[model samples]
Target chain A: MKQRERLIEALLALSAGISVLTTGGIIVMLAVEAAHFFRQVPLGTFLTDTQWTPLFADKHFGILPLVSGTLLTTGVAIAVALPLGLIIAIYLNEYATVGFRNVIKPLLEVLAAVPTVVYGFFALTVVTPFLQRLIPGMAGFNALSAGSVMGIMILPLVSSLSEDALTAVPRSLREASYALGATRLQTAMRVVVPAASSGITVSVILAISRAVGETMIVAIAAGQEPRLTANPLVPVETITTYIVQVSSGDVAYGTLEYDTIFAAGITLFVLTLVLNNVGYWFRQKFREQYE
Target chain B: MSNMTRNRLLDGAFRAVGLLATLLGLLLLAVFLLDILRTGLSRLSWQFLSALPSRFPERAGIYTALLGTVWIMVLTALIAVPVGLAAGVYLEEYGRKSRWSALLEINITNLAGVPSVIYGLLGLNIFVRFLRMGSSVLAASCTLALLILPILIVATREAIRAVPKTLREASFALGATRWQTIWYQVLPASMGAFLRELFWPCRGRWAKRPRCSCWGCWPTCRLRQKAPWTSFRRCPFKYSTGFRAPSRHSESTPPPLLLCCCSLRLG
Candidate 1:
């Protein structure tokens, strides 16, 4: 029995170490590859170059275009998602009857489960055309459609998470508001929403990070022209899409083009990592304060 | 307008906006599903399920992708379940709230947020290049196992946490060892919820990338050789358009959950 217990403990410890191992591997691999790339291209040039024509004859390695694309798409996505998601959460939590909440909640789950690639297809075939018809300047394949679909893709993430946050507010708070004769809307918007703001902020930040890291939707629908512009109506290439593009090509390992893939991945990783850490900090703060 | 009337009107308008937001999300989903079904449901005959992918769109099928998905899900489960459950068990039961464990907790949570494509990238580096596994089924499965690890570990911890403390106390009082107590008592009690949490998120991932073949490398190989018009027509359609059943399945789960919660509350 003693021997068996020791063996089990060893196995459990090894299992726990695997995640730590994976993170270590990613950091080391990305660092080595980034170091190799920076040896060829200066870090200043990579960051400040306005043109992102890496594969072109001139081979300008400016990442401004990629960053712009990611930002534009993320900005568009958040604009659509945050308000809609917050309202959906408020509706489910405060106004809806139990029956209504049950139905709407599952619908949101299904909405959340719908694949990004499908949204890619929807943007490509359905949303883009519909938008072009409605707005004269809308490109057939533009960031607007992709961003809109991504918004829909992330809608449930924001709503469900924000709803969880809202639900965690003490019931006594709601009862107190009611005893003071506040309307349901007043209680939800002023009392409950303020109480859940930290969680809501975390959700929004997480969603923004997810949007920045999104690939397939942008790859398939958002046009691949790397342009250093902030316009959502135009084609743009994001860091993620750039990675996907390079990976699909036969860029030999260890080549400058190949190393750029790692550089792009590193940037995307760092961007999301910052957002995630901030979101994680807020989540921890909220959990501790509430509990 | 009178003060009370104006206040009531504002409340009604906000309520309308909330209801509209809920309906908008549902409406978009309904349209997405209807669009997929209209285009792809008719293509789901037995021949579509049985035939190999062909050059012609009319003849191509999802036979490879379907089998590949099954292979991935099964293989990923084989690798992920034991490790994830053990990690969760160790963290919750054996491990204490030390600095190391706290660091581990943050690492796991951060890993959970890393993009799936980054996992794809890492899989390419480690499993394919360093380990020389290539982009075969094993490599992709390993990547997916790593991808699902955070979810599985977190879920297992939550499930184990939910198991009443009294159950473990009873087993210990009976002179059962810790391993024996977990295996016989806590494990059995939490299996259903744990499985749901583990598999549901993985299913969500699969739903996210239904088009990815046994390993992602295979599909990329096929695409690199040619324009891949047939793949554009088939793989995405098969994976994304084929989710109607699961949506219906998700719909069935909540009603019963509501029923149980109501019963418990009443009792």
Candidate 2:
């Protein structure tokens, strides 16, 4: 019995070690490649240059355009998702009758479960065409439609997480507000929402990280032009889309073009790491304070 | 405006807006499904399933991608399940709380949110490039196994944590050893719940992808473009959430299930 116990413990510890090892591997892989890329292009030029014409004969490797492109899509996504998601979450938690709530719950799951690629396909083939007719000078492959669909895609993330947060607020607080003659909307908006503020902020930030990392929608719909403009109607390329483009075609090992992607990957990895960890921090803070 | 009449009007307006907010999401989903079904259903015949992929969409099939997905899923499950279980049991039951254990806990949580495409990049570097697996089924399987491990570990830990502590003490009183108690009592009790939890995120990985990324969606799509919506059915966890939640609620927290069952039934 003693021998058997030791073996089981060893196996469990071994798997736990593997998890740690994988995390180390991710950091090391991205770091080493990115370091090599920076050797080819100076950090100053990469960060400060305005033009991102890497594939052209006059190759200027400015990362600003890509950064701007990413911000454009994510900016539009946050604009759409932040309001819609918060409102829906409020409606789901504070307003709906049980029967109405039940119907909406599965609909939320259905909306959430639709594949990102399916969203990409729909955005590219259906929505883009429709938008072109409605909005003048809206490029067939533009950031606006892609970002709009991505907003819809991450709607559940924001709404569901916010709902979870709102739901976590103790009933006593709501009762206390009601006893003070507060209306339901007033109680939810002023009392419960303020109480769940940290959690709601975390959800919104996590949604931002998700948008930053999203690839397929931007890859399929957003045109491959690495442009500096923030205009929604024009075509733009994002960091993830650039990675997809590079990986799809062979940039032979150890080349400058190959190195650029790892550099971009590092940037994306860092940005999302900061955002996601901040969200995780807020969640931890909220739980520690409340639970 | 009279306070009573104005209050009633505002309440009615709020209800209408809430219902509309809910309906808009449903309308978009309805259109997406309708479009996919209309475009892809005629191509989902047995011939499409059985025939090899071809250059022309008319003559194309999903056999290769289907087989690839099945093969990868089995391999990933085989690799991930045992490792996840062992890590969960160790972390939850055995590992004492310390700085090290706390770091591991936080790492696992963060790993759960790392993008799937990043995992694909890691797979490209580690399995296909360094290991020289050459983008084969085995490399993809390993990539997916790593991708899903954190999710499974989290689920297993949650399930084990959900199991009542009193049950373990009873087993100890009955003179059962730790291994025997876990194997005989805990495993039997939590296995159904654990399996359901473990399966959902694995399905989520493939849910967003029909043609697995390690395999590349473009090559297969170029070979056969017809079966766009074929992936919808294979992912069971989406709809199964509604069915699975209420049952598990009763098992874990019988008292709360009375209150939780209604909300759990839909989502």
Query: Lowest summed lDDT over 10 consecutive residues: which window, candidate 1 chain B?
Result: B217-226
lDDT (Cα, tens digit) per residue for candidate 1, span B124-177: 888877887765667766887888787778878878888999999999999999
Best by TM-score: 1
Clashing pairs in model 2?
none
lDDT (10s digit) by residue, model 2, range B3-33: 7677667767776776687777677767766
Interface RMSD of each: 7.8, 8.7
**Runs of candidate 1 exceeding 4 Å displacement:** A286-291, B199-267
Question: lDDT of candidate 1?
Answer: 0.73
Q: Give fnat of each prediction, in order.
A: 0.45, 0.29
Q: What is the Å distance of residue A182 in model 2 from its true position?
A: 2.7
lDDT for A186 in candidate 1 is 82
Fill in the DockQ of model 2: 0.19
Clashes of each: 0, 0
